[model samples]
Target: MRPIVVLLTVLSTLIFPGRAEAATTFGPREAGVNAWPYHDGGQLPKKYTGVVDNQGVRMFVHPGITGGRKMNHPVAQAQYGLALVNNYRRTHDSWYLDLAQRQARRLADTHVDARGAWYFPYRFDFPLSSGIGLTMRAPWYSAMAQGQATSLFIRLAKATGSAEWRRAADRAFRSLQLGYAAGVPWATHRDAAGRLWLEEYPGPNPATSARVLNGHIFAIYGVWDYWNVTRSPAAAAIFSEATRTVYTYLLRGFRNPSWASSYSLRGDVPSEKYHNIHVNQLLHLHALSGQPVFAAMAEILHGDFTMARVTATIRFSGGTHVGVAFRSTTDGRVRARRGLTLGRASSAPVDQRRRIGGQPGFWYHVTKGALAGFWVQEFPGRRSTTGPIATFPYLTRRTAVLAKGSHLVYRASGPSVARVSATSEAGIVRLGWVDGRRAVLVSAGSLRGLWLVVTPRTTFRIAEGDDHDEVICGVSCERVAPLG
Candidate 1:
């Protein structure tokens, strides 16, 4: 009888679309095969309006509604920027490229606060003279926003050969560092085992201080992108540290047969809602670091997905989006293991709390449906490695070696001819790698965007070659040519 009733209820809802309260309605033309509506398919209310800047950049306009508020989170902007850039590269379409450039410029110039920080604004209908107000005013910054923006600027710099884009990225990175350095201190808690847990606010405010797994991944992305651009040691230090921190606190929470949405800074599970963003971020981190730990973490998310029961299906672009209701691996309730309380104290007002943790909770209402397109369009299954190893065959046969301090050293066990080259904005030129003791310079002039290569001698070390006296006369060789 119960099974029959459940079947009839589902059949009735499918038969009469209006019976599905959460279903989003799309216009005849706007609706694609698999497209789902955003937050019940409603526009911004009469009072809350969006701002369009002079650069044709739209600000404060958001898709979806949670707590009667428009969800204008900054992560989407960065993701869209990347999607546009990817499209431009694929089609060589000037329009896509132009839009990407404009978007990057707008975020860097218009959205940035006077302190060189980027703020997420809820509403921005101020007069032209002043600026965006009523932001989540705190020292803490969104790594999700800044990280993606940093990558956009780096890509722009490479595409345009512009130093300004690189500088813009530098400032954004500095702002993230400021957030970590100056944000409010964490509130600590101890479990039954007496291990203390530190919890910092997750970017929005103190009330939502419980750490989230997906949020920290964006910060890692930001630092990694910056490190790749400048090869900055400072950025590398931060990136490595943050990577371990995520590994320790958030990633470890996956030890359960299911994944959690929120965890204590000490890695205790508070909310066990499995999220698609976890899979997305893990895949991203794996691509960036080429580490096995991230791959292992992603596999856990996949394992949990296997247990989900598909409740409904919606057609979206290019594929079908299935809505799955998760089944818990540990009975049905979200129980805190090891005798620790699940809930945390909050400073957020009643309204903010209600909005931040709405019916389906803030993360779900905002991202659940939206993430389908994001994962499908913006994030693909695999990406090229971002490590120092060059993927292009034209650059060299071997790509593992990198420069250190005043010298780059490579050595070969056998005597063989070696050729090394670097191509930058300056031009294509050879690089100084040791044939013997000979110090080689690709070109006499300054080399910008320098990349090096070597062959035959599997191992060799090359120095600045600027010191002729240090050059081994008979044993050492140097090649310097004027840029033609």
Candidate 2:
């Protein structure tokens, strides 16, 4: 029933556009106070007459009441606060910052338990039995909600010079860390015998295993943030182990070795799935860990893009449009193209995969000024057993590419030949030297809108080679010459 309700809400959100604006009708004043009150599942009154219930809680019911009232769960509140903070960051809006702080304060005061732990009940109506209710207090739920709360608190503390919020965040972090197993920090929940459990709500049936990797990843992010704030080695160690476990176990098993179809713990991989966000997160993790394999996997996942069959509205031709088909494959067909201004056109149908030297070569399109060109390279396969291809500049203003054997280097700054000699970090791709002046590197696979960090002193020159191959940077190259 709960899952069904969640699905319905998600479906409604997908079907009806502009629902968020309609839902937030009060614009932060509907709850009768400056802060928004938590709503249990039910319709809110159309009119905000500033009414208070018997328990002194504000009436937060939305319009369109239905079975199961909406209450302010700690996790939801935390997410709300995070969203507000994000908005504030973008707009520098004081109203959003104030609202976010108010909610953060409320969560800190109400959710932190007497045992210095943090937990929230399943709903406002649920009794605070056994310290917290199962629905809200579940390890997975708490980690997510409390993790956001912690992040918000830390951000607030930094912004407002508030030690109280910082303290609350620290307490929350401690509570979550203590809840996990000693060494296996990746596991979210634990059994009574103190054994690590991967799935948050593991049911008796194998099919009901609720082991989604998102929650664990969120928890790790929270821990990593905490470590950044305090520089605690303990926190850093926990974060590292959690990352290692996720990449080594969860991610590896989720995708097919052939890099086709979406990987899932519950059987067949779905087509046209958008787990690219997850893949992106893993890429960041790989960067932090410097692991080559994880880097390679990220490249494969992104480069060999798959599409799921989903219907969505896309804006094109500089006008509001609708009814666009979205697929999971990297080379899926686009139903329509919109938003083209003059020579500026959408490159949605570009085929990145190509064949070179008995191997599958992939080409990425680059456009600068009125000029557009194609960058061609080979895909990394197990049999190749080489490093990245060659380091060059991606046409994108801030991106640089490197090739080390069969591995590809995508950095924000230019890569130094000296730095490439170091051992690759865990879960990242390692580049090997093909020669003194040239090296081969594999692609990090399908990434978009991500920045690569490179060295500041390196210089590049554009030189045209055979088969339309353009070299942008070399060991002693100084000038970048454009190829016509």
Candidate 3:
């Protein structure tokens, strides 16, 4: 039997539609087809409204949420099931599938079969300033919930051949039909443009709409799911109409000029997270309809031109001694495993890292340690490292050190990185390490600003580099000279 819930009151003192702000509706963070991953899942015990049931689910009625006592959010629950189902899809794990089935059963059982529409409703009242409304009453439903539930049910039915899931899907589609007015509450919203939008919030007045972008897209996914699996003519109509609305008004209605996509038709900007969602949804829409416009916008919105990149290494002059700096395999400057240091037990060099932005001067990858990855110059404070980086000590009498640095390029900031800054002479410089006493400077000029070490020494021999891994030339290699 379905739950005996009714449509909440409208145009009351406590409830009305919203205009400016946009808050997150309880649903999937990312937009895509079925089997898409869920960003979050089932709530922790602390969120429970203290009402427990045999189904092990409770209403999450936190204070400051609304004026009503408590209520279970069908939208949230349906998304949770989606997460579990996708988890099962990725891992072939039966546990997640079983849990998803149970969730679908709950949704089917509690559906409000009233006014000739099988609507799944929100039991609690919406808080003041909610993007959907300022003071929404209890038992309100949304096209998003109905669509997601419809998607959820039909998916399970098709995959598992369950009769109950299909029946629930059929009934849920019925609610998605009528506009959110009169006895039929919350589903469709026909905009002023005459484009029929599956509204996220068709608040107290059915004529008004939140016209939320992500919500509309998510609901379309459900309708798309229905049409794709069952090929019902009605489902096809809904899918066609909803996507048509998106394709037609996507830029004019939802885009905010050169900024992030609008949260609603109200010219409100979305956060970075939601912007990513927008990009994904647009790309997915392009795939679904082969629309060039969505793909072009997605590419533009997902700008990667400002990424950082490192090309090569720089060299410094050490008078008598050079401090060993380790570029650990764990440093953000370490882009990838550039092959291991042969025969060495605990030290290797890496070339890439992330989040090294706003850091000036040259950045050297640190050695392996417990701390999170951070950028460094040729020298840094004492830390742990199994491999050597480029930092050093034994500064000039005045203590002014110079080094090379790099800039950002396209790609993930933290995925991996390259070398930082430069040298003028041979485009390279190597300051050899002495026995904690002497330093070797390659064609080193003015070692102490006015001091010069002669190349015509009685005896000069090529030796191991400061990293103790390879041998370099002892005399002037002709390609390097100190900046002096």
Winning model by TM-score? 3
> Between the candidate structures 1 and 2, which one is better when assessed by TM-score?
2
- Indicate the residue-level lDDT of 44 in model 1: 28
- TM-score of each prediction: 0.44, 0.47, 0.53
Q: Which stretches of candidate 3 lie over 4 Å from their true place?
A: 1-54, 66-70, 90-92, 128-133, 267-270, 304-484
Model 1 Cα lDDT, one tens digit per residue, 1-484: 1223433443343223243323322101111211211111232222212443454344444332233333344555565566566666556776767776777876765454535555433232211111111223333345556667777777677667789888888776665555332243222222333322222224233333444455566656666667766787767666655655555444334343333343333234434343545655654554455443343344334323221222222112233222212233333332221111113321110110010111121111112333321111111111111111101111111112212223332323423323335321122222221211222223223432333233222122111111111111211112322110
Model 1: lDDT equals 0.38
Against the true structure, candidate 2 has what lDDT? 0.38
Q: Of the candidates shown, which would achieve the greatest lDDT relative to the real structure?
A: 3
- The CA lDDT at 314 in model 3 is 25
Candidate 3 lDDT over 1-484, as tens digits, reads 0011101111110012121002201111223443232323443222222342455443455666634445567776677667666666566767777777767777777778766778887766665332444455667778888888888888788777888888888888887777656655767878776778887766676555577778888887787677767877787677667766765565555554334456776435443336657766765665454433344344334321111233323222222212223344223244322222223222223243211222222333433431113333332111112122221211111111222332211122211222235421211121221211112332233222111111111111111111111111111112212111
Candidate 3 lDDT for residue 93: 69
TM-score of 3: 0.53
Q: How much is 448 displaced in model 3, in angstroms?
A: 51
RMSD of 3: 21.3
Report lDDT (Cα) of residue 101, candidate 2.
75
